[model samples]
Target: MDEEYDVIVLGTGLKECILSGLLSVDGLKVLHMDRNDYYGGESTSLNLVQLWKKFRGSDKPPPQLGSSRDYNVDMIPKFMMANGTLVRVLIHTDVTKYLSFKAVDGSYVFNKGKIHKVPATDMEALKSPLMGIFEKRRARKFFIFVQDYDESDPRTHDGMDLTRVTTRQLIVKYGLDDNTVDFIGHALALHRDDHYLDEPALDTVKRMKLYAESLARFQGGSPYIYPLYGLGELPQAFARLSAVYGGTYMLNKPECKVEFDEEGKVCGVTSEGETARCKKVVCDPSYLPNKVRKVGKVARAICIMSHPIPNTNDSHSVQVILPQKQLGRRSDMYLFCCSYAHCVAPKGKFIAFVSTEAETDQPETELKPGIDLLGPIDEIFFDVYDRYEPVNEPSLDNCFISTSYDPTTHFESTVIDVLNMYNMITGKVVDLSVDLSAASAAEE
Candidate 1:
């Protein structure tokens, strides 16, 4: 217990576990400890009884809801983009060998009081009803431009530099309507709001291109993928990778106390009166509350349903993005659903989640737009949690803290958070440029 380590991770959340794995793979001595007995801290999947107990304050699940073992409900619902950063990480660390994945069935965006499939390719763009005929042609041209864009190829630049141009300018160049821009920015690019429109166009273009590439990866209905059981498998897979690289793990370590020297730099962490010495500490914000502050709040509804989300083309698994413009809200609402086909539920059962950044005191009213889209729900649970970000300087404290997960129902923003934390902890960007295309589980 007195042995020293290069880094000590203090949570079993997806972000912490990934950091532990990456650091261990970098040949650093690592020890990961969690206050809970479970592998995933806040991101663990719950069965029917556990879900009911957590939300309803009882262990009694409805008899009509089927067996408890048939439900693998993710506490923090998200889907992986087939060609996104998380997939690159999985392949870079060879973690896919420890888990299996299947393509999500559909992706749609809400616009102007109707739902429409998000057009990632030119053919889909031409056929999409979200835009008028002229707007569709403009959108297709934009998509073609993005698909052919090459940073190193001057000819593909089209007399415009995305690095300096605002996304608004790029969209105006193609004469796309405001509605078309809304879905492109908020849905396909997965931006939280319209703020990205005023930012540099390069990142937004890259995000849209990634979405198209991911959709093409599986040639499926959507660009996303989910694991066999649920998202809980992800942290465990990373834990195994960390273990294979000699990182030690402990769960149910009560009252994990981060010890600091007189100068306030971290020296070790103590649990059960046994202190494990370390040069630095990596942890989620929950481990060091004093160093973090609430940046925002997330309101979500976990819904158990007998059918898939209505108007989603009967997809067993799907995501629907309700853009803020369509709902007259400040932030978009996300709906995610997976059914028996995804193995996250029993036969004739579906699990869906409606989530968004809380913009008002009444979460139920705020989420009503998304909830109404589910048609009807069997049982529903509502949760609102504060999102925290570290305010302390990691260099001064030798403590790297991960931010709380956001309300978005995709891994793009989550992976960026992880990558930023990795850079801050290791002083180098985590290189994840592995060939993820070859690792896609898509079998045509």
Candidate 2:
């Protein structure tokens, strides 16, 4: 406890753990501490008994749910894109060697009161029932334009400057209907709201390309994947990477209060009256509450089901996006489902989650639209957590804090937050241009 270090990470969440691993690999001495005994802070997965204790305030789970050891329910559930930024980071850091992944079975979007598979490529758009024959042709042209887009190749530009054009303007060129635009923006681009419509089209086009490429990776059903057990495997895998690089970890350490010097820059973290000295401090919003502001609240319902979500082709795992316009809400609603095949639940059982940015105080009522799509739920638990973002500057205080987890069912936003913090901490962008073949090697 007397030794000084380069950086002190104060949470065991996936973001903090990943940073710990990356910094340690960069030859920075890191000391990670968590007040909780668990490896994951807010993102921890719970067994059946622990799940019952959290939601029901009792340790006893129903016998019909099977043994407690068989359940690994994630508190902050999300799926990884098969070829997205996080996978690139996993390959860059070589952390994927510690984990296994399985491709998600479906990615559907709700439009015109029915769910349809998200058609990312031109061929899929032609075969999609979501659009009329003429509309499909227009959509195919739009998809082809996006697929051919290359920043470095003038031949692919087609006289359109994506950086200057709004996403709405780009879509208007194709004359796509409102329904087609809805899935293209929310399902493929994974935007939380229509705000992106007015933003430059460059980011939107890149997101669409990423989606198509991810879908092509496994050629299974969707563009997403999840670990065999649950998301709990993520933080633990990074923690192991950190350990292999000589980072120290301390759990069950209570009262992890950040200590500042007289000039108000981070100097150390004091836990149980022993101050572990470090030049910079990295933590979640909760560790330094005064440095963060409440942005919104997330309302979610976790369900244990005996069957797959209806209308998803009986996929063992799936992601369903309900666009905000369809729900008459300010944000989109997401549904994620995984069954025994993922080893997150017992045989014949499925775990599903419906989450959204809360517009009302009643989460159960707010999430009804997504819950209704589940068909039947053997057991369900409703939860609401406040979202937060940092208000302080790390340059002045040397204290880097991560944002609270959002309600989205994918890790795109989460990884963005992590990468942004990594740049701030290390003063360098994380280069993720590794070979795609390296990503597949992670599963082996």
Candidate 3:
């Protein structure tokens, strides 16, 4: 096997497959392989039998659960923001033609002890019950500042340069309370933690703008969207794109052993006694444990339900973020729900996931705040997996490794990881600027 490739991707995860597709479209020859027979490695959707087999092990699924083929439960649950980076990538690569998307119905945040719809726009801010009458006025002013904010428009700056101001300082400038700042920073801005308070306001403002723009795109109750079936559709769609661009894919290839050159750089990958020569390799952290370090742990609980999550306004699908401060924790907890409405489950069945960054050995205890919100569940399964990040620089070894998925319900953090890796590999940043007309066409 003397065939040489510009890049070799050793896993079928979403990140690797997306990279392969983008590189192939850029005219780089790519060889994509996965040890598993499926397209998604860590991020796959499983049917009832497969799902039960994975979690329950050897035990047969209950007959009352209906047809096994009717279920498509994602191992790692996450949704895409319609106008977010992932959607932009789909439109940029024309991958939307391979998939269908439905807007999520709700986005809620936990405050004190109740769930409230995140008020983003000024109108919502004015009517929001989360704040007192006086507080609503202050929040409305803050929302106005954010909505009118334009980096290039001095008229919209309001005498405070967001680039030079900390997010905490900007919040104080608007006279926002701690509770208002909590949801604004965690729910609307989608920050993982309150750590962004000390960071520049520019980042938080940009994130808030993205949420608003995405919400305006569909005029839906929420800013996020999910593909029909499940997230597993994403990797396969990208795989199709890579194939159309002349990239090769091999699945069920056993023992994918990576080879290193004398200079300690990736030279090729060996599988089934044949070596596929390539200049560089990209893969998930699992494929190269030695090159990765355990960063943290994610504890998640997957539940099957007969109805929508309580207090979500009966939304067919929803995302609920519980800010750390509300739960007296150091990180946010995510609640994601989808069901027959999204074609991922049987009729009248709903799937909900509660996940958070694990701080102790007890995951169920750590995620209790989120799980308590689900009134009743038919079946529930809990899982905890370690998170990993690469310790080596891609420029040094030519071996690029993707980090483990975080405990996020949205794709914003995931896409950021992908874009950073793309820049590292190509030595150029992928411009995220979108042409309004093009985005509209894709939506149509």
| Most accurate candidate by lDDT | 2
Residue-level lDDT of model 2, residues 96-176, one tens digit each, is: 787888889999999878888899999999999999999999999999999989999988988888889999999888898
**lDDT of model 3 at position 316:** 85
- RMSD after Cα superposition, model 1: 1.1
Q: How many clashes in candidate 1?
A: 0
Error of 1 at 439 (Å): 1.7
Tens digits of per-residue lDDT, candidate 1, 1-444, equal 689999999999999998999999999999999999998888899999989889888999979999999999998999999999998898888888888899999999998777789998888999998888888888888899999998889899899888899998898889888888888998889998899988999999899889999999888999998898899999999999999999999999999999999999999999999999999999999999999999999999999999988888999999999998899989899999998887889999999999999999888998999999999899999999999999999889999998899989899888888889888888888777787765755332
Candidates sorted by lDDT, descending order? 2, 1, 3
Give residue 64's lDDT in candidate 3 (0 to 100). 89
RMSD to the true structure for each prediction, in A, is 1.1, 1.0, 1.3
Q: Model 2 Cα displacement at 92 (Å)?
A: 0.9
Off by over 4 Å in 1: 442-444
Q: Between which residue pairs do clashes occur in model 3? A: none
lDDT of residue 350 for candidate 2: 96
